[model samples]
Structure formats: structure tokens, C-alpha cells
Target chain A: MTIHHHPGKERIDAVRAFNRFYTRQIGLLEEGLLKSDFSLTEARVLYELAHRDGLTATDLGRDLGLDAGYLSRLLKKFEERDLVERATIEADARRSSIALTKAGRQAFAPLNQGSHEQVATLLERLSAAEQDRLVRAMQTVQRLLGGSAEPKIPYMLRSLQVGDIGWIIHRQGLLYAQEYGWDETYEALVAEILGAFVKSFDPKWEHSWIAEREGEVVGSVFVVHQSDAVAKLRLLYVEPSARGLGIGRRLVEECIGFARTKGYRTLTLWTNDVLTSARRIYEAAGFKLTDEERHHSFGKDLVGQNWNLEL
Target chain B: MTIHHHPGKERIDAVRAFNRFYTRQIGLLEEGLLKSDFSLTEARVLYELAHRDGLTATDLGRDLGLDAGYLSRLLKKFEERDLVERATIEADARRSSIALTKAGRQAFAPLNQGSHEQVATLLERLSAAEQDRLVRAMQTVQRLLGGSAEPKIPYMLRSLQVGDIGWIIHRQGLLYAQEYGWDETYEALVAEILGAFVKSFDPKWEHSWIAEREGEVVGSVFVVHQSDAVAKLRLLYVEPSARGLGIGRRLVEECIGFARTKGYRTLTLWTNDVLTSARRIYEAAGFKLTDEERHHSFGKDLVGQNWNLEL
Candidate 1:
């Protein structure tokens, strides 16, 4: 799933705009953060010191990405103001450790409370669902940018609800087209499949697993009864942001588990070879390649493969 | 358009997660931002000094959300390093104005380039389209959070395209449910209306305008032909994020313009009075209330009003 993009001028400009907008939104452009006397950087430093114990100047400089001279000067000022104090480490006498003094904690309390209240004020303009959407959008930005973006809640599988099918069709259509240069035909194919699945849904044998993280759908897979003894897996996909979290493998395993529990002897799936990520997940789940064929579809010449697992 | 929300534990936790994730993503948690010697705060200060001229400590403290003492200490360190120089302000003898020195600019050049390059790297992992999605998501967060969030690109109206109807239905359904506590019945009604609109679409007499900001739909309206001389406006909606931007009014005006161009003498719309924001837009657009009725719909007892405009 390595997509190499040459960002155009538009993307650069858009990102710059967002940075400016967010800076203002978060009061980073204000005289003080959250109407408090601490500058954004000062507030950050206070927050770190208040939350942790015995952090060295090196640690603060490195973690905060501050220059050593700049940080030491800032710390000295904090010490002068009686907001922080330092002690020599017993084991590492040369390295001094620093922590917030009582005054420092007192100063940080208002800053912390102010930030919480500020965010609360922002959230107050939205409904609970919109708040969720806002947070999800922010999380999406974080995930796409790449970082230690762990989902706050582990994804849980659930049955599809109203609008889920349409959402899946829309996303899959757009994603496939973007990632593989597939056309609207791919979207139409998905819509057709889902429409049929919904029209002829059988709860006893057919099931769907929509993986959700904090209410946003991150992945999904569907099990369709092919025969009394066979179940077919379809539409296995994990959102790119949600990938690398074993979601793909988990989705495959879910299909296998469900098929076995349903008393099916075999589970099968078909996918294009270009979908190497999905193929790897399937293969790792002990599904063996059973068939392959050349196909002209979605405006591309591709190799389609089928895999089967004896449940 | 005022909405009151109480931040729940879940919302607070989600925001905290986003803050932590973004802090790491932007390398605020790294030893040095962009692998430079400047901490995130130092980089920010240098950036401001480089971009602007003759900023006083007061200005820097206010604009960068830094405390006066903290900023003065930082500036003094920069002065010692020959990265910054200060001069007494002519108008205010008590104030000193600061600017980045040649050495400061030299140091800041790499930091500026590094920030740009890092954002570029993040964009490079996504396709041009995905890059657009990422920026749009960020903007959505900014808009929802409320700030000086001016749209970089003003919304434009375009004819409805594939998936627009489904998206409108989906969003309207969810939004109405969230805002008004409407039920699934509202969604079904929208689907039915859209189904009929798509089925009986007449380019000569019917039209739809979708308001788009940077490729994402922000609002939509449709003009349906009820008779040769009458045009009925249907399903007008503006996303809450886009509300204050006058999208709703623009959508209504678009409908009126299209109806007049189509030579319709009368343009009419029906909406609930409880939709105060929308009703204001209609009222300002020279629409006059023609009929009102108490009705039970979407599991809520409500007043529905019909407004008419003569072209």
C-alpha cells in the first residue's frame, strides 16, 4: 500500500491554509494560550513538567524539539521565578534533573483547565454526533500524516446498519479508483453486489462484520452462503488509515471463524492480484490459492485470483 | 445556528487522543522538530521573526501565545547567539523592537524548509486525490472547531454528479437525526424524493445545484417541475460546518435563478418552521409564506410552512 504522490502546488497551499486556520483556532496566535499568561511553548513546557517527574534538560530539549541553550535559558527563568527546581541525579551526578516546583504546579493548573474549557467551548457548538465527526476528522488528519496514531478504542465488529452499505459503496468506489485507477464501473459493481446482498439477506447463514473504531467504520467483510457446505467472503477491506493494525488479517479470520461456526466446510474469496495487501492477509490466514485468470475489467488488464480455506 | 453541547467523557478522551497523535505527527514530541536544533517553540519564534519585521516582545508574546517573561528570555538567548538583534522603538522609548539577524535567517531557512518538506513527505504517501481528502478533513476539523476559518476556495455550484444524491441523502439523514432528533423516516422520505427526481430528471425544466468547497459538497438544492409555469424547490440543505458562510442563501438564490431561467413564474418550497436558520435564508430571499399546517412527521409533532416566490 505504498502510494508515492508528488504533491502539487494546490496541496501545499491547502496544507498551509489549514496550518494558519488551526493556529488561530487553537489560540496559538493569541497573546496567551487559553487567555492564560503562558505562551504556547511555555504552556507546553509547563504541561510536560507537570505531568512527568525528574525530566532532564536533554529530555525536555529533545522531546520539545527545543535548542539546549534556549531550553536552559527558559528553565533558568522558571527557576528564578520559583516555578521550577533542579536536583543532581544520584546515579548520574553530572546530569541534573528538573521538576516543577509548587508554584509551577499552581501556574500549570489554570493553563490545563483553560485548555480543557477551550476545547469544551469548541465542542459546545456541535452535537454529540458532530463532535464525534470533528474528532474523527482530526484523527483522520493525524493518521494520514503518519505518527503514533493509535485508535483510542480497539475496533469492534458489528452488523451493518442503515447507510453502511451506501457508505461502503461510495468509499470503495472512490478508494479503488484513487488507488488503482479503476473507473465508476467498480463502484457500480459494488453497489450491485450490496444491493443484491441486502435484497436477499439471510441472517442465519449470511452475515457482515463492520469494524468500527469510536463509531467510524474502519473495515468490513461479508460472508455469503455459496452452498450448504460453502461460504464466500466478499468485500474485505480495511481503510488505509486503519491498515497496519492487523485489521485486514482480523477481517479474514472473522470470515473463517464465522464460516466454521456456521458449519460450512469451506470459505472462499476472489480478488485481483494487484490487491497484494489483501492477498497477503488472505494467504496468512491459511487460505490457499485455488484459481487464477486474466481479466479485462475496470479499465485495466489484471490477474484475478481465488483462494479457499477448508473451514 | 447556535448549538449547545455538553462535552462527555468520550468526547474529551477523543480530543485528547487527537492532540497527542497530532503532537507526535508534527514532531512536537521529537527531540528536534524537522531534525533541527530548534525546539518546536524556537522554530516558531524564528519563523515569526523571519517572516515579520520589528516585532516587540509584546507583539511576540501576544502573537505567539507566549508569556512576556518567557519570550524575553528566549529573545535574549537568540541575541546572545547573534541570531536576533533588538533596537529601541522610536515611537515608544520604553519598548524594544526585535528582528531576525542574518545569522537568524540562516538558521531559520533550514527550519522553514524542513517544515515544508515534512508536510510534503506526509502528502507524498497519498495520491493527489487522497491529498485533497486529507486537507479537506483538516479543514473540516478547523471549521467545526470554529476559528477565523475562512474557506481558501469559495464554494462553487455545479450540477449533481454520481453519488451526490446518495451523499445528500446520507448527510441529510444523519444531520436531521442528530440536530432535530428525526427518525429514519426522514431518510426514507429523502431517498424517495431523490429517487423520483433522478427517475424524472428533465434537463430542460429541472436542475440541481451542489455547492462545493474544494471538491467536497457543502450544500445542495433542486428545482423540480410541478407544472409548466411552476417550479418546486426541494431538499435544500447546507452542512453545519458551512452554515455561517451563507451557503444556504446561495443555494436558494441559485434555485431562484435557475427557476427564472427555465421561465417558471412561481418557485415554491416547503420547510419546517423549526429550521430557523433555513427559514431566515428563505425569508431574506424574498420568499413569502403562503401556507402553514400543523403536522406529525419524523415522529415529531411540528409545523410545516410553505413559502413562495414569484419570478
Candidate 2:
């Protein structure tokens, strides 16, 4: 519990351990990367030059977070090796643009190819699905640590697969418990609903969607057959880590589309008013509050509300 | 196909992108980490000193992969700041042991605590399950890239959970296809087996154990009722990344233990000769090959073998 409010030493060590592990994994611990003659920093500098158009020493230092003196020294080494060429900028007399020379590109190509091969070798051991999982996990860590901005990776939706139900049950149970002090019953309710849905799954009338970003499941929603004319929207939830990406709204929209495609006259859902974020999403999806009742569930006194959207 | 033979530019770019993403995530691009006055390198040096005892300047330079001149200058700065005290070694006049002073520890404590809190905040958004997934994913990347040796992390076995079935099927299907050129029919067979197991799971007679290292599922085995007196071991596998970790051996042992505890007279399994790694583990665990049949399946000629262990 002490680790709850504050991270325990164990968690900190885990991060540090990962850092050490990755350093070795990437061969940063070695004198040179991928058995190349250039040091890790040198390879990084070479990479920047090989990829970017033209950069001044200041730009390189700033972008790479390198000290001015150290960067200058490294650049000098590259220059002496004929791996880089510096030309004075026409518009800026004080600045010179740095670029990879033919020799530089030649030196860099093998290193780049080696890195690619190394990563590919790592990935080849895994199945395609696991490769995706690995990439997504890396992206998750990057996103969580506030690093994913260059491409701003988008989320994708796919039909629910075999394991999603169990994950949903487990996540919903723990999430509700952590956020609202809900008990095990909420998780049991989820399992029961999902179990029945799977047991009596009608491909013609029922469908589910799971939202993923960088290969991580961020949200989910389900539509189940209720009657010939109506469909029930159930178990709509988005992960807190992926909350503001509009995944909740998107999930609702998908539900609505599927319900309409299946010729349902109305889509209805039951939820607690305590879930304000979900409420906002529901309300925005044009679901009207049709009923409200006081209920004690999940060990909390709550107002249960039913909403409906006419197709 | 070109990517398989030789990694494409995209794969190389993915690694570079991840590197960029991670650099930003860890605040290595910042002038000072966590808004502190220490550069990333300086903080790393401080961390090393605080964690270890009597490390000489040479040790720090070698371990950190820092240039001798750079390290000396940095140490000089620390000495001027009253942050580090160095003493000449008793036996060697040329070697000086570096130790952090009280002021250095004071400066480092907040930085260390800051890093811990940052990682904590990132993990807090995830449910425990998701957190475990993230950690495990990281460990997988590290292990695949040849890290994870400091503590030699061990694997553990746990009861099967909801999402595990899907993962097992997905991994098995893809792994077989990749490694043995087996087709989707193999995947379908795994799915059928897993589906039937879940649909008619008997807690008293059937049990599955998932092997996890750093929260990543590395291997699995199931002991299911072949008869009242016999238990069938199904879907025994260890990920290629997790091979040589003895997880396969452990999983087989776990099955043996469970079958004995359940009062089954024998534990048996059907496997292919192509699975030489698994065959070794079974043999090591005292399993005797009792049957073999040459079969044409999964797009290749193969020999199937059945092995059993007496309780």
C-alpha cells in the first residue's frame, strides 16, 4: 500500500534494471556499436547527418542534447575522418551547415544496415502477432513517458478476438476497484455478461469492437441482440491512459453504425451516473436519459441510468 | 519478403524512431533532467557514486563509457561543488577512490526520487494487468535484444486466465507458420483444442500452467483428462526468446507434479520430431517415447511422436 501513493524502490529498480538491460541490448555498453569502429555517440551523430538535410553545429548540439564543446570535438573527429563536410551558410555568416560526405555516407550505410538487421533478427524470433505486440509495447512505454509525438500514432479498431473478453473482465474489474472502490462483483458481472454474449453470439445481430493504439488495447464496446427491433449496447469502457484520444466517442459511433446496419430500431444502455466521462460520451452520441434509479451495487450507493438512441 | 531476407528501411526507421521517442521520454533531451541543474551524464555519474562504494575514476569511466578527459573534468566540477570527495588508494598512489559527499547525496536523493515518481505516475494510469503487460513487454524487448543478465530473472508458473487462451492460440499459430512453414490448418487445430478445453474445462481434472518471466508469458503446458487414470499434456511450448531459460523443462515438471497430485497414473503428450527442443525437455523429465508415425501435414513430411511418463 505504501507503494500506492509513492513508488516503491522495487519499481524504481525495475526501471533502472530495464535501462541497464536496454543499454546492453542495444550494444551501447560496447566501445563501438554493431562492431563498427565508431562509438555509439559517433554513430548517433552520423545518423543525424545522414538523415537530415543540413544542420549547424548549434542545431546538432541542441537537438541531440550534447554539450557544445563535446559535440564540437566529436564533429572534428568526423571531419578529420572525411566522414562529414561543413559548408558556410550563405545567409548566415556565423553558421556553417554540416552534412555527410560521400565517405561519411559510405561509413554510415553499413552501420545503418547492421542496426536494421539487428532489430530484424530480434523481431524474426517472434511471430508476426508478437512482433506487433513488441512494437506496441515499446510505443506504450514511449507514449506513457511523454515521448510519442513525432508521428502521433493513431488508434485502430478491430473485431473482438478470443482473449479480449477475459482482458476486458480483468481490466474492468481492477479499474473499477481502483477508481471507485468497487468490489469483485463488478468483475463477475462483466464476466457473466461476456460469457453469455459469447455463448449465444449471433454473427448476424451482435458485434464487438476493440480499440488499439500502438498495439495496446485502449477501449472496447459491445452490441448484443435484445429483441427483433432493439439492440443493447453494453460494456463500453476506455483505458484511462488513452482517455482523451476520443476513443470513447468513436466506440459509441461504431456501435451506432453496427446497430443501424443490422436494422435495429433502437440502441439502449444502462450505466451509472458516477461515470461522468462515459456519460459525456453517451450524451454526445445523442443518447437521451430515459430512466434513473437509485441502486446499491459494487459496494457503493449509485444512481443507475438507462439511455436510449433511436436508430 | 525482402524484409525477411534483409531488413527494409522501415524496420531501421522504426528503431530510430523508437530511439528518438525513448530519448524524449526519459528527458535525455532536456538541459537538466526533472528540471534539476544536472545534465543526464552528470546525473548518471552521481547515481553510480551514490549506489556503489569506492569506485575509482577509472572504474567510473570504464563502466559509464565516458572519455577519460570528460570524466576528469566532470569530477573536477563535482569536487568544486563540494559534492564528491576523492581519496588516494592505500596500495596504489595513482588510483583515487571517488565517493559522493553529503551535499552530493542530498542533491541526488531528490533526482532519484523524481525519476521514481515519474515512472510511478506513468504506471498509475494502467490497471495492474496492463502494468504487468508493459513491464513484461519491456523485458521481452531486452531479452530479445540480448539484455537481462544482471539478476538472471527466473520464470514462474500460474493458473491459466481468460486472455491466455487467445494469446496461446495466436502465438502457436504464428510461430509454427514462421518456424516450420506450417499453414493455417495448424492454427485451426490449436484453436479447436483450446476452444474445446475452455468450453468443457473441468477444474478437478484439467489444469493449465502459464510460465512467465518478468510478467511475459514465455511458455505453457496443460494437463487434461485423457481418461480417469491418464492425463494428456497439451500445447507445451517455450518462446524462442525464452529458450535456454529452462522454462520448457519447468513447465514439463509442473505438469508431472499436477498429474501426480490429481492421482493420474500417467502423463502423456503428442509432439512432432521437428520440435527437437521440446523433445529434449520431455526426455530429460523422464518421458519415454512410445509411438511414432510418419505423416504428411502442415505442408511438409513429418514424423509425429507420442511420449509418456508414468506417475
Candidate 3:
């Protein structure tokens, strides 16, 4: 049961407007759906079967919101066309389970292929940036509509995976180039740092954390042994798209906790003064600026700062 | 005509999967539409009538993809209930235009409100950040689905409006606090600077540019007179959501162009070393660092750098 809210007139109108526009847009695509031989309902039924096995006609009808009689007739037509086959649900012999036949899979393959082609054609026209914006916007709608984008503990911090090192280097390189105009030298620096971290073999004294969401890596950080009693935090990074979720802070906190648990006396990190956002997080997490120097790196004259936290 | 592309099988499945998810979500809401008193089609007809000004039965049937006889009978029922009125289309005197009667509007009010409430209820469960993500995702979908989110000139530079200065201050304040963890003093500084700008206004050499997208202000920058021969750029800020789009660079360029066109010999701006992103744009646009000073501002130890571009 849903509790109701009295939304203002303008809010109601805006939503209705969105609905109208979306309906029209979907109608335009309805023409191209599943190569037009199959109606949208028929295509959808085929799609459900293609994606899942052992769904009963009752389940499909309930899921599709089709009338019982309408679904029965549609399934009958599908059976006649040899696109679907039914078998007894082993647990309840009285109930029948629905699955697409080999012919049904073949039929759906074209429709599926056509839909993908359609979306690809749609997306190809956009720049990569626009595609990102579109995808992000879609995520927003889904989230706001009580769909997938929930904010509760969005991403989990896990141990680094095999492919993560390369991904981190590539992302750091690309992102620095795009966001800060740091050139190929930045990428080179990232590669060198990550390479060095991976080349070292010490599981007891060093640890790495990778922030993952929806099977995607969003951030990473490493704590390495600088001395027997000191751990160095290195290669801290968060995806620009995933930034405001406190991933950087969490990663830094993870570093601090690991350093403490490993009996390190102090944790130290080096960063450019220009990276203010990261610096702010460090400052908040009890890291004090210990030293500063002017240097040339990544194709720019930069101010470097060292921060340390007493464990 | 759309050109066909043979996307990979995995990509096709992904699109189909999203379609299935979205269709099911929409289907979940279809139940709430008519209160079991009317079918989805009937409610949709009422919706169209409630939102739109006028439509003939033929037009409504065409728009709804309804069978002619079915729509005719539906209209007859509505007329019997005094829910709709018809009048001649004037130029096409033989045809009729349909408009909702007072009774129609009254009857539709609760349904409209219910739908609005439904969406609100869906959204109310999400965190604000999740809501932002959801809305952004929806925009993305609309853009990709050939709905809205057009890519032509995402933002336009215009003179500041009545509420823009306040909006700029509030936004800059809120954004800096959120992104950089700047304190209330930073917002106070913005207010003071803007207040000063408003007090000593010059319409000739000094100018302000507000970047507007979809009728909302996304960025702002201003040129103020430091001397008769030099123009100072001030308050250069862009909304984080709108950042990555070169608005800052364009705004700076606009300042340079305006300063030169207005016969100023040079343009200057003061920023911090920590503002690396802005600094890069300044460097790219031929601004040379002239001076640096250690200062305490925005409740932090900051390096203030002065940049000047010679016209």
C-alpha cells in the first residue's frame, strides 16, 4: 500500500507532460519493434521466454499483465507456430512451464539483434560525453522511479582483482587528461606507479582496496610498506562519475585503518597541491601537511605536498 | 531512414534487458491507472482529453491507436456522462473537435492527482543524490530514445537575469560546500563580491555571462573594471553537473573577447593553485601567471595566483 501525497498542480502537469512525450516516443519505436511481423506484446512474450527458462503461461501472463484468455490464445498461437514448447513443472505436475523452442530462439535472435541495432544506431549519433549524460540521466529516472539506482551503501570496497590494476591506470590516465589537461606523461606516471606496486611481493605488509558497484570498479587505493613502521598511501583514485559518494574518503579511511592494524607508526602520502579535493579529504581524516616542494612533473611545474597521519 | 548496424550479441541482450525491465515497471503502474472502473485504454483517453485542449474523436482514436468503432463507443459513453463536449473545427465544419467538459475535468482531477502522487511516492523513497541520478538517467534514456535531451548547443551564454546573481551565490556556496567542503564563509565571500559588483555597476566595459541550459542557469562569469585599461574576470563558476563541457573555457574566452572588444588592453583574474581545472583553462587561453601569495581564505590555507592576458 502506498501513502499518497498532494503534489502541486505544476508538478502533476510536468509529470503528465513527460509521460505524453515518452508515450509518443515509444509509439515511434513500436513500428520498428521485432521486425513488425510480431506485435509489441508478442515480441515481449518472446523476449521473456528468450531470457528466462521454465516460466509458466500463468507467470508470463501475470508478468505481462495480459488477460488470462488473451494470454492462453496467444500461447496457443505460439505453440502452433512451433515457437514455444510447454512441459510439466516437475515440482507441481499439474502446472505447465513455458520455454522457447529452438525455432523460437531463432525467431527471437533476429528481433533481439534488431533491437540492439536500433539502440546502437541511436547511441552512435551521440558523442561519448553525450552518451554518458544520456546514460546517467537514464539512471536518474530509474532511481527516482523506485528502480535500480538506490543510494544505500552504493558500492562495496573489495580486494583488488587481476584486471583492476590496468583499469586504474587507464582510467587515471584518461581522466587526468580529460579533466586536468595532464598529457601522456600523466598516463606514464600512473602506469609506472601501478607497475611498481604490483611488482612488489608482500601480502602481509601491504594491501589494496577496490571500490566496486554493479560489477564495475569505481575507485581504488593502495597502502604500501614505506618502512617497517610506516605505510605509504598511494595511487588513490575515484571515478569522476562516482565522486560525490564519499568513495575517496572511504578509501583513505580504509588505508588509515589498514595502516593502524598492521602496527605502522605513521601513514604518509604524496600528492600535488593542485589536487585539492583529495587534499581536503586527507585534511579531514587527521592527515597533516608535513612538507611541500616545487617540482616539475606530468609536463607541468607543480607544487608537491606530503601529508602524514600518526597511527 | 535509419542505417542498420549489426551490433554484437551481448550488446543486443543488454538493450533487450533494459527494455524488459522498463516495460515491466510501466506495467506495474498500469494497474493503478483506472481503479478497476475503466480499462487502460479508457483511462488513457481520459488522460489525453484532460491534458490537451481539444481533439476530435477521429484525432483521439488516431493518437491512441484505437479502433474507430471502439473509440466512437467510448466517446458516446463519455457524452452520456456529460464528460465531454464537441464543437465544429470552424475551417473543417464537417468534423468536430472534442474538449473536456467541466464534469470531465472534475472527474479526471483525482486520477491526475493519483498518478502524480504515484510518481511522487516512487521518488520519495530515494535519497536526494539517488533522485538526481534517476532524473539524469531518465534524461539519458529520452536522449537515446529519440525523445528530448537534444545535443545542439547544450548551453547558451546570456546576460544575468534578476534572480541569477542570488542563484549564483547560493549555488556557488552550496556547490563549494558540497564539493570542496568550503565553510559558510565562502558563501559569505560570494555574497560580498556579488553585492560589490551590483553596487558599482558599469554597462559599458564590464559584463557578465550566465550560461543557461534548458532554461536553467548552469554557469556564470563576470568582467569587472580594475582600471580604465585592464578588465578583471571574477566569480567564474560552473555547476558540477554541467562541468566537463568546456563551459568554463568558453566563459573565459567570452571574457577575453569582451575585454578586448571593449578596448581594454588586458584582462586579469585571481584564482587559487588548488583550482587546477580552472588554471588549465586559463593557461590554455594564454593567461600567464603574474604573482602568487599565501593567503587564508574559505577557511583554509590557500595559494592565490594572479593571471593576466595581454590583449
Candidate 4:
């Protein structure tokens, strides 16, 4: 009896062909959208500005991966067209905020409409299940490609707003509980950390930011005052969904920058030995493992670790 | 007992930082190599010309993913520099072959040496085992990324060559033997197919191509005579290592172009039901299942499948 071998290669080839067809189709669609109203660069800038309502030119450069000089020239062009307005921030005279004009919004509305229509048309070709599969495939591609891009340390640092601290405590507590058995002591430690962060809040001396992508908050960190000589790095948490994009490194760099500007000579943070990711970020930011101690307090005993960087 | 969870989030962060570091390092190394003797674009053109040896401006455009017009300009620049020479093929005035000059070889050697040195330097930073792991990881990344690029149908077609037929048989035999428990009968079928391909070769009516990437042959296929009203596609095979890059689709497109030029109204092929990959290539190239048959042959009971495409 001859066993029929499965046609695995054929199925893979079909999928490969579909991928090629889909990419080409999408390229054509994007080109069509571009020809109608905007050049690719202008459209990208519009998309970035629309998503980030008030970003500095420097911030736009970082976010969009544009050269600073080129971006500056583009911004000048946009300003000349009266599509975007730039003004010095009253709070910080050196920094400028960029906001779209009424005409820009009017242009953006139609562009957004056309984009949505194009996406809908493409999605319409696939069955509901196929659309789901395509979206999942796109997410996989994004993860794979995004994983390859260099992680950057974001220059802009803001303060921890409402819901940010709560998220950190909740996520960390849950992850820790899941990994190590649910421990009251671990939860208590997290609460204490949260309380300390909230109690010492100083918008002028301290700051935090939730790193965002596609309108969703993915990671965050905070810089808080310790003394005139030093500042404490606190609540550095990156969500699992956003782990590979270099958000943690950016968060750590934000803390370092805040410390540097606020006249701190040293930066310090406490973590556990098991938290290798945090340790790596600290080390990459020029921190050295100055000291470490092992202690058992929670139901699941683990060694606690501390790391520091001299800014 | 508490299960210690692996630090997935942390590892991801470290990996991201490492990627940033590696890309920047590599970019700097490449720039250093360029500053000494050649511009970046010149180095790339030389590298491509060196590796391909006899590729035309058109072939370079397709392989390097450059625009034909742009590639033509670059080739003109290389010709002006006396680094490359282009000559019309003896049989066809329309076809041109490009070859690198002695100066091109001299320029390419140091660039290649610098690249090797850079790789060595990177490897030196890691332990021997880490170096091996890094190479393996890079292979995986290249495979995944290279496979994801969309395939295109080339506008020009070239006739079948000896290497093309050899690869087709070797790949088909290996893949069939591994995937199905085919024996000498399958080998016999392959031999017969090759013999028929060689016997029926016509420069004006038939075409074949050996799909290449990074100086390696990875796939091949053929178009041959059938009847006054029909043309037969044959020996379509992509090596296992290059299976996912849509090489089969390009080969089929070449065959289709040949068929159209030769005034054939229909194209067809025969295969076993187990050859799913070929089936997919046919389907994606706008073919449909036209016939199916089952027969016990070569000491094993198996069913054969036939498919066709209308021009």
C-alpha cells in the first residue's frame, strides 16, 4: 500500500503567491491615494501630526524616523502653506509645539476618508475569516519587521498621568503572581512602590511618560526626586504586547535625561535578580551593578537586586 | 513549588537594544569601508556586478530591486569609470551582458576583505558558541526576510540552459523522495522529462531561467512544444532552501510569456497528486485543475494529477 504524501509545499506556494499579490495591490492602492492629494512624505507627516496633536519638531523627527534637517525644511514648507502652525511653548521658551491649522484638518478629513475607503475595499476582497487571517498575518509581519528596527531612546519625557501608575502596579503584580505563586508580600511591595511614586509627585522636578504606538499605550517609566544629589528611577514597566520595540530602553533614557537636567549626579533603581530585562536596560544606559543582596520575604523566595547609574 | 517564569519581556528589551547597537555598529563599519576608496553606491554596484559576473543592466535591476531607468544610469556611470563593460549577445542584439573590469575586481577585493574583518570583529566580541548562535540567528533572519519579499514576473525571457535542467531534476527527485516514498520509477520519470526537454528545445519558441540570489542558483523551469494549439510547461522546480521566495511563480511567468510569444493558446502540465507545490504555482499563474487519473505503477499504487492554464 502506497501512502499519499500531503501537499504541504503546494499550500505554502499558494500562500506565498497570495502574499505577493496582496503587497503589490496595497502598493498600488497607496500610490493611487498619494497621486490624488499628497506626496508620500507629506502624507506621512500629516499622519504623524494627526496622531500626535502637539509634538515638537524634534519629536516628529524621532517618531517618523526622518532626518532632523530634512524634517525642519518640510515643517517650514508646511508652515508656509499655512497647513500647520508652530509656536513656542510658554512653559518652556526653548521648545516649540506644532499643531495643524483648520485648513489642514479639512484636508486631513478627506485623506482619512479616502484611506479608510481604500482599506475597506481591500478588506472587502477577502472573506470575513480571510480578513481575520490577513490581519493576523499583518500583525505577524509587523512584529517580525518591527523587531528588526533599531530601538531608540526617546528624548521627550512627560509626567506620570492618571491610570499610568495603576497599570504598572496591576500588570507587575499579576505577572509576578502568575510566575511565582500569588504572594501577598509581593502585592504589598508593589502597592508601597505605587504609593511612594504618587506621594512624591512633583511635575517640575519629576516626570513620566507612557510610550505609545498606533494610539495605544504600550510602556512607561518615571523619574522622581530623591535629593539634590540624586534622583530615583521608578515604575519602569513595558507591557508584554510592546516588549520588543525598545520601549524599556527609551523609558530608562528618559529617566537619565530628567536626572541630568534636574541636577542629579546619580540615578538608582531596585529590582529582583529574576528581572533580567530591567537589569539589561540599566547596564546599557551605563549603569553598573554596584551591589546586590539576596533576601526571602514573599511566599515564593527570590533574590532581590539593585542597580544604579551615575549620570 | 513556585514556577519561575522566564523573563520574556526583559529578554525582548535586551534583544531590541542589541539590535540597535548591532545595526549602528554595522552601519559605521560599512561607512568606514566606503570612506577609504569607493562611494557606498559604487561599492554596491561593484559588489553586484562582481557576484553576478555576466548579468545585464536589466537583470541587475530585477535582482537588486532597482528601477530599470535608474539602473541604466548607474551602469552608464560604471562604464564611464571603466569599471564595467557591456556587450551585445552574439545571437541576439537586444540582449546585453555586463562584465566587471580588472579595476572593478581590485576595488571589490578590499571591500570584501573589510566586510570579512568587520564580521570577525563582531564575532570576536562574543564567545565561540555565541558567535555560532549569532550566525544561526542571522541565517534565520535572512531566510525569513528574503522569503517575505514579493516576486515579480520578468518582462524578458531567456532560453533553457543545461544548469536549469540539472537543477530541476535534482530538486524534484530530492523533494519527491523525501515528501513521498517514491523510488526508481520517480527517477525514471525525471530522466524522461529531462530528455524530452532537451530534445524539444527551441530558442524562438521555448524559454527557461535559473533563478539566482546572492550568487547561487535556487530554481528553474522550462517551456516547450506541445501541439499547434497548445504549449506544455515542464520541469518547474525551486530548491528546498529557496522554496518560499516565489521563484516558481516567476518561472511560470517566463513560460507563459514564451507561450504567448509562440502563439500557443493553452498551457498544461502533468504531475502526481502529492506535488502540491507545483499545483499551487499553476493555480496562482491562473491555471485550473483540468484532469485527474489514478493508476498503480512502478511497484506502488499511486494516483497522478494533470492541470492546465488557458492563455
Write the residue-wise lDDT of candidate 1 on B1-311 in tens digits.
33456988677757855764455445442333735787777877887788788888888777767778888898889999999999998898989989998999998888777767766876787765558768888877867775434446668889866667667767887788888987656765676576567656789999989999756788999999999999999999988766667788888888899899889999999999899988889889999999999999887999999999999
Of 3 and 4, which scores higher on lDDT? 3
RMSD of 3: 13.3
Ranking of candidates on TM-score, top first: 2, 1, 3, 4
**Per-candidate total of colliding backbone pairs:** 7, 0, 14, 5
- TM-scores for all predictions: 0.60, 0.66, 0.57, 0.35
> On a 0 to 1 TM-score scale, where does candidate 2 land against the true structure?
0.66
**Candidate 2 has which clashing residue pairs, if any?**
none
Candidate 4 local distance difference test against the native: 0.61
Top model by lDDT, which number? 1
TM-score of chain B of each: 0.65, 0.64, 0.61, 0.49
Q: Is the docking of candidate 2 incorrect, acceptable, medium or high quality?
A: incorrect
The DockQ figures for the candidates are 0.24, 0.17, 0.08, 0.01
Write down the DockQ of candidate 2.
0.17
Tens digit of per-residue lDDT, candidate 3, span A100-183: 999999988888767777777766665554555555555445445644444566889898544455466556766676667765
Error of 2 at A71 (Å): 8.3
Q: Where does candidate 3 stray beyond 4 Å?
A: A1-16, A33-37, A67-70, A117-128, A143-154, A158-311, B1-15, B34-36, B57-70, B143-154, B158-253, B261-310
lDDT of 3 by residue, B63-103 (tens): 87778999989988988999888888888987788888999
The CAPRI classification for model 4 reads as incorrect
